[model samples]
Target: MTMSTKRPFTKDIILLDNVEEVTNKIIQKLQQDVLHNLKRLGAVVGTSGGIDSSVCLALTAKAFGPEKVLGIIMPEKDSNQDSEMLAKELAATFKVRTIKEDITSALAGFRCYERRDDAVRRVFPEYDPMTYKMKIGIKQTGLSNNLPPVFSLTIIDNKGNQEDKILPVKEYLAIVAASNFKQRSRMSMLYFHAEALHYAVVGTPNKHEQEQGFFVKYGDGGADVMPIGNLYKTQVYQLAKYLGVPKGIIERTPTTDTYSAEQTQEEFFFQLPYGLMDIYWYGFENGYSAEEVAGVMEESTDQVKALFSNFERKKRTTDYLRMSPVRDYYGS
Candidate 1:
């Protein structure tokens, strides 16, 4: 098999020039958002051993000396052990102050797993929570997949066996509620440190996740400043390389890091890989026809249109997540 080269459509989105200049602008923005807007001494970033957070942390450290930034590792029982270790490793390399807050017990009061499991048992009666992990996903219909994805639940047994079944609406709601607690819990921890140190909480989402509504509202979505939110995932990687982020982090795959069953961002939300998805979103935003983009990306027109349709579907479904809580007409 032969490897594919960069596609022409990348010109519409990927920023290939003046990476240093762009990096400087983001650095200034982070400083301005924290020191000026929030009047905070520094910024607090929850590092997940992923490139987005790693790059965000590096930028924050550069903006306000490494001593000022705080890196918090908030892992729970389902969190990957390597994530915590890598987060610490990134902190040490950047010379940023670090702290660990295991939130498994704190989230216990929420009955996260129990409620989720209760719903799971409705289908898989013999599913043992202790010995297995569960993940929810959508069934991809076809290239021209105009219809909404059929959501399904998947369970992985300890012996590495796997099972997939259609998810009831109640089960989907329960699982999502339980998983979201993890993000909200981490956000709470970050605020605790930020409040204590008079620092701003820095969000790590890239343009794709930010614009596509991929983040959980009032959870990972809550932040004083999103340092990398304006950059596409590919551009974020460009900065990552330019900023000398840890090689391990720069190369690690982007994951939801939300579920115990191990799922990628593409699997959970975006159907395409971040690199490809970024350009597609850009193309869609700029009003490029799917057939036009398909020709450049070497994909079938139907596939490109399908992805575009899916993007629109997600945006509509998640629009509510982007809103502030409702109040009285007087803005109470």
Candidate 2:
């Protein structure tokens, strides 16, 4: 019953100290693994015109050749065309086949689930959409132990101090819900493509997010093998440049573009830029205590500890990352 005090970020944080070498190693290894693991395999990538996907596309194309890599771009109705454009550009740049799938139809279906009839049934059902929707707009802050100081990150770096301005949390969640659904839908498409081609779904999430457990369960984190899961954001940029990722894709502030993410990805993490974050988080990922990690980074002690303590949440993310259907266990 005792609460565990270990900082979560240290447990599974992928080290990116030697990013160029790490990325090359991961990409080469995965390519070889997939080549040997499955027959007639062709890799599939979901390209959102984001930095992560661009890097993945470039590397996958290089390793497997353009004919063997497919890029799928999933755009929600509200999403800007820029994302789609970037995905297509990267696909062309890498000479990969491109598919565009709009997810507005699916979101409508997921939202339209009816709760018809019986009052008792309407009142309670374990799998009700209403119940799941209730997960939205609730006072569920601090649910995860990671305590990433997301607010502090925002307020600290935002020059105008606009981070404290009241944000529509409910609306934000709804928007994110729709956007995440689009991601999951696109991922489903990616997996199906992989299945047809007998190839692996190449994962693009990097090391820092893995440590912070920053992904939806059975969602974005799932992949056959994460080619860039070992790289840090700081390092990913360099590799992107090395691999010839377009300047626009590399320079555009990192964002899920979920819920109109005006703030860059770093801003959401309390304005802690990746370069600055990597310096200390690198330590945490390498088993340095929060105090020790913070000490070198010159960040406040409590905030840094909060980031480290997110171990349980990180563990859950790792579960999702490692989880998949067991073909052997199913007696195929």
Candidate 3:
């Protein structure tokens, strides 16, 4: 049987090149919305070290004073120094009140009786919480007489740890399990913090993720508000400049930090360059049919035709995910 594509669950996205003017306007509105709600409700943002969350934090703090915004960094035992460092830097630079919690202890507390090797399991395993990537280090196997390029980049899963690999939902049960555990941990962590301080749980997902149902249902997906939801990958970068977020944060690859600090979310999920996918989303969302979109961004005639074929092949799942649910039995 042919492989089945994952259905889209979010709104239909229309592609519009150079959407900066309109998108920026929406972002300003979102910024104001976040500001109005948080200050009035005594809400703070639970920030992670990732770009999306960091960007949201910057926007939120700008709207509300740094004193009013609370940022939290939740890193597990497997978290890297880069992730924690970024978190600490954000707190210091922005003067946002911060709480640091390492979730390894929480994991241990939950699995009080498990053997060291047996390891603990989580309820929500669909969400992998760590980002892992392979460092292109020392590729010279036998080059004593000649010099060679010192570094290159290639895909490595979960940085160096096998335990944190981001897995597809249809694939391995363990990765899916771990993803669920970490994802819920993140959601609950943010929500609990949100409630205690009267802050909103800010969502940090992207359009591609939103379209593909990449988030856990009601777990990571549930949020009080989203400051960065409407902004696509490129648009966020542009806004990041306007917000004064650190260049490092802006430069870092986009990843969930769910499996390991090295893995990127886009690389793990689509295994395709994010630039390509961004264009894909742009085309679909901007009212172009799959055929028409292929014409614009397709690299060559063969590529365009291939895209056409794929679009026709994936039409069902594509349409399903693009269009809003046709049948909703309950309104509430």
Candidate 4:
């Protein structure tokens, strides 16, 4: 796994040469962690019709029998219709049992939409939930620029007329706190099924999500075992293909799907496309110099360095998300 400075640094550097082996290793670890460690009868996965969840569901089915795996499709009012469709398709493909739990009512009860919209209206006085869709995304800070990321709020009216504004910190925090309810609600549903069925909840976060802190701490981040946590986004796609995931899902662009207005994972959080980000991240993690990466990426050295710096900043800031509860004093 030595990185050669003289040799070309291509995307191939991250490609898994032994896809089958990698898949089997994950299946084995999952079985061990769930059946032995967690003492669970089977595995429960929250499927979003996305690549990560699809691959997780497939691995769960393979690790335990298909009958032992339960795919819970949790959708809310803001969720994409295609997410449910693809999630169902994924379960069917693997012969895993699935149950749909629409959390729209639950979210309403929790005032999820109302609270989020209330914050949106603070920024856009004319915002009306009935007539408008809203989303928040990070403004591109230019990976090479070493600038703090800024978030922008967007409201789209019925006619697709759109307005954008810089999100004040207060509104941004309020909006995020409210939107997180969707994930927290979905997590509650997954745990209920897991407990009832005596199955362990399997997480679907990839290396980027886990390391870069793109996931909600106790929401999507709550799981007994994470099989793909170590694999990069590109590697997850590799596993999806190896596992025969549906073409539609494999080809689907990654999205936030948490917002009503359409937004991509890139625009919402990760600034660059997964392909470029993956390579740069790999270089950064493996101690590759900026000049070396720049030579390979054909970008300026300072630009590569800035991207690396950004990665470091994200990890540092999100480190708290990955920590266990602080317990300084135990009874002696």
Q: Which candidate is the best by TM-score?
A: 4
How many pairs in model 4 have backbone atoms within 3 A of each other, for residues 3 or more apart or on separate chains, i.e. clashes?
0
Error of 4 at 145 (Å): 1.4
Best by lDDT: 4
Candidate 4 lDDT over 1-332, as tens digits, reads 98756545665799999999999998998889999999999989999999999999999999999999999999888889999999988988999989999999999999999999989999999999889999998887746687879999999999999999999999999999999998889889999999999999999899999999999989999999999999989999999999999999999999989999989999999999998889999999988889988998889998888889999999999999899988868874
TM-score of each: 0.93, 0.69, 0.67, 0.97
Clashing pairs in 2: 7-308, 8-308, 8-311, 146-310, 153-270, 153-271, 154-270
Q: Rank the candidate models, highest lDDT first.
A: 4, 1, 2, 3
Residue 14 alpha-carbon offset, candidate 2, angstroms: 10
lDDT-superior candidate, 1 or 3: 1
User: Which candidate would rank higher by lDDT, 1 or 4?
Assistant: 4
> Over all chains combined, what TM-score does candidate 2 have?
0.69
Clashing pairs in 4: none
lDDT at residue 191 of model 3 (Cα atoms): 78
lDDT for predicted candidate 4 compared with the true structure: 0.92
Evaluate residue 255 in candidate 1 and report its C-alpha lDDT on the 0 to 100 scale: 80
RMSD of each: 5.0, 9.0, 11.0, 2.1
Instruction: Write model 2 residue lDDT over 222-313, tens digit each, in one string.
Output: 77777778777877887888888888898887875643224456544324567766665666556777676656556677766666555445
Question: Against the correct fold, how does model 1 do in TM-score?
Answer: 0.93
Better of 2 and 3 by lDDT: 2
